[model samples]
Target chain A: MSIILNHVNYIYGEDGPLAVKALDDVCLQIPDGQFVGIIGHTGSGKSTLVQHMNGLLRAASGHIYFNGEDIYDKDFQMKKLRSKVGLVFQYPEHQLFEIDVFSDVCFGPKNLGLDRREAELRAFDALRKVGMPAELYYQSPFELSGGQKRRAAIAGVLAMSPEVLILDEPTAGLDPKGRDEILRQIKELQVRTNMTILLVSHSMEDVAEYVDRIIVMNKGKVMYDDVPREVFSHYKELEKIGLAAPQVTYILHALKDRGFDVDVNATTTGEAVETVLGALGRKGTYI
Target chain B: MLRDITLGQYYQTESVIHRLDPRVKLGGTLLYIISLFLFRNFLGYGAAAVFLAAVIGLSHVPFKFIVKGMKAIVFLLLITVVFNLFLTPGTELVSVWKLTITVEGLRTAVTMAVRLTMLIIGSSLMTLTTTPNNLTDGMERMMRPLKVFKVPVHEVAMIMSIALRFIPILLEETDKIMKAQIARGADFETGNIVKRAKALVPLLVPLFISAFRRANDLAMAMEARCYRGGEGRTKMKPLVYEKRDRLGYLCIFVYLAVGITVGRLRF
Candidate 1:
């Protein structure tokens, strides 16, 4: 019930002069029901790593195992793997092509050989989970607003009922409010379904607030993998690679540098608030 | 995988041919194609091959890269060869499974293959050496006389260059769309022809919509910049004929004259 990678390496344009090591000797294990955030700068192999999880991109070397089965085995069914580990690509709204949002969401389940009634039911449930209004289900996906379209696209992957869900930058190109809505829905989904969730994101604030564990990647290699607070504690090193900890982490550290007794390891704004109040010996008075 | 398409892609290099005027390269390509039609014998073919080889050498573009462009036209080459191999009337060489093979048919097939190969290689050479901007400038300048006859030369050139520029962008878009669909369990491979064509609906619909959206955005951006349909538009890097351009023209005319004479001579 876990996904494991062993010494995975992926090289783009292999053997050519422009060869780029997109993923370099990476190894990781994601257990069941874990919400993990993968954060990296652009071209840091974040997308490449997620694609490999679902067997979409084959590693040039090493192995991937899903639920104790070697995915690269000759007898392994890739379609089955894809169904169990659903991936929502970046700008997924662009992949919606059905005349209506409901039909588009049913596409994934139908591909799994589900009957019409069952597929429609799954689509209905999935859309509801994403908080897409029932009236918008029959509307053309193309006519939906950007945030709505994005939610519908997420529902498209959700209909498959994957054991593990991977979203690559799902909140990209959304307004701040829309971004919060999507992340909240995703957090609720993970809690309700108890599915292993891998959220690839660029925003440290969103990842720190939502995910339980964080994986920091830089230059096609894993730089740090730990709880959000532990990973953000290396914020100075993270900044050296064009990435930063959440703003709250920096604020807490600045407070600590000014001789305050605040816990500088807090990774989110709420945690920082509690830490600051406790440090000022006024924790119960703030409420 | 779409990036493998080498047609109309410039190969960056510091070489004699790369530095030549785009107009000279364009005219040379036209003359080369015309010479292919004029040639009727092996001697003319040999002369053309020599000229092409020399040009390719001077361009500094790898021969393998130029040959990669030929992979796209292999089917057309096969069709031409097959038609000429069996349909031409001449002395009978052999009969295989109800089809007659003749001496004239063999000769025509071989000659057609050679000519077609040379034509593609020659044209691709020009594009490989010159950027699309330079090619557009060359065509617009060369077609200026057409303006008197109501031909919007500049507009036509602008459209041509824009289309060329969009090829790579559209290719990248297609790649992304395909991957996204595949993630949704949309199988594009491992299907029969009709099923495969049906599978493309998901891909094509999204691609068309995105392309239209991009086109709309580009149009608005151009309008915002006050674009007015190529009227009195000036280039920042105007085309200028250098000394090497003159030498290039001289070499092209000499090859053309020699090719025509060698082609007309009886074997």
Candidate 2:
């Protein structure tokens, strides 16, 4: 019940002058029911790697296994694998082409050969899960706000009842409030459904607060794969590749440098505040 | 699978053909196509094949890549071959139950196939070697004379260049849309032709919307930058005819003359 990539290598435009080695011998195991965040600078192969998880992009060499079975096997049903491992692309709202939001979300379950009634029910359930209002389900997706449209697009994917959901920059271009709402709903979805979620994002703070693990990529290679705290602890190395830990991690580090006995490993603001208070109380110092 | 499409895709290489002025390449390609029609016999086609092979070799583009482009037109080529083999009125060479093979039909079929192949390759060479910007520049310069008749040649060229620029981008967008839909279990491969096209509705509607949105954004950007019609627009890199262009023109004329002379020869 895990997605395993074994020595995967993928190249775009092979042998051409524009050839790019997008992924290089990437071996990773994504355990089921875990919230994982993948972060990297642009063009560092984060998108390419996620696409390979469900057979969207075939690896040039090596293999990807879903639930201990090689997906590339002749007998494997790729369509089923895709439904089981749903991928929502960046700016998912642009993918809404159906006339109404309800029908659009039904596109997924309908494709899975579900009856109209079952598909609609799934769509409604998925929409509810994403916190989309019931009254807006019949409205045109284009009529929705940016954040609403994003939620609707997510509902479309969720309608398939995928065991693993991979979102590429789900909160990109959203305001702070919308970002919080979307991320909170995603966390709740993972907890309620016990579905493995791979959140591909650039927002270190959001992922730090939500995801259990972080995988930092650079130049088509995994530079760090650890829990958020450990990953942020190597913020110096991350900065070399045009990446940084959450803002709170930097603040904690700065405080430690100024003679404060604080844990610089804090990745979120709340944790940093607690660590700072603990350090102050331990030292019996007045603020 | 969508990414396999290489139409309007540029191949960058430093060669004599690549260095020639875009106007010369455009003229050469036109002349080459005209010469292909002038060739009625094997001798003329042999000259054309040699000319085309020489240009392709000189261009430094991989032979396999050009040949791959041929794959797209294989169906049309097959239709032409089948039509020519059976439908042409000529001396019967082989007679089956319902199909009759003719001697002249076989010859004409092969000739037509060669002509079509050469035409596609010649035009592909023009696009492959010349950047879209250069192609647009060359086209605009050639059509400048038509402006005297109140033709919007510059705007037409700008539109063409923009369209050319968007080919790859649209292809990438199409790929993304297709994958997104496919992830939802849309079966594009298994269905009949109509069903397959119906599947494309999900792909195309969004594509058209995105394309229009992009065009709107581009128009806004251009207007923001004070882009009026191509009136009084000075070229940063002006089109200057060089010695290589002249040499290329000479080669085109020589190739056409050879093809015409070969066509005139009997036996």
TM-score of each: 0.94, 0.96
Best by DockQ: 2
lDDT of 2 at B233: 94
Clashing pairs in 2: none
Give RMSD (Å) of candidate 1 vs. truth.
2.2
Error of 2 at B55 (Å): 1.5
Candidate 1 - CAPRI tier? Answer: medium
The TM-score that candidate 2 achieves is 0.96
Q: How well is each residue in A93-114 modelled by candidate 2, as lDDT tens digits?
A: 4579899999999999999999
CA shift at B30, candidate 2, in angstroms?
0.8
Chain B alone vs. reference chain B, TM-score for every model: 0.96, 0.95
Q: Considering every candidate listed, which one attains the maximal TM-score? A: 2
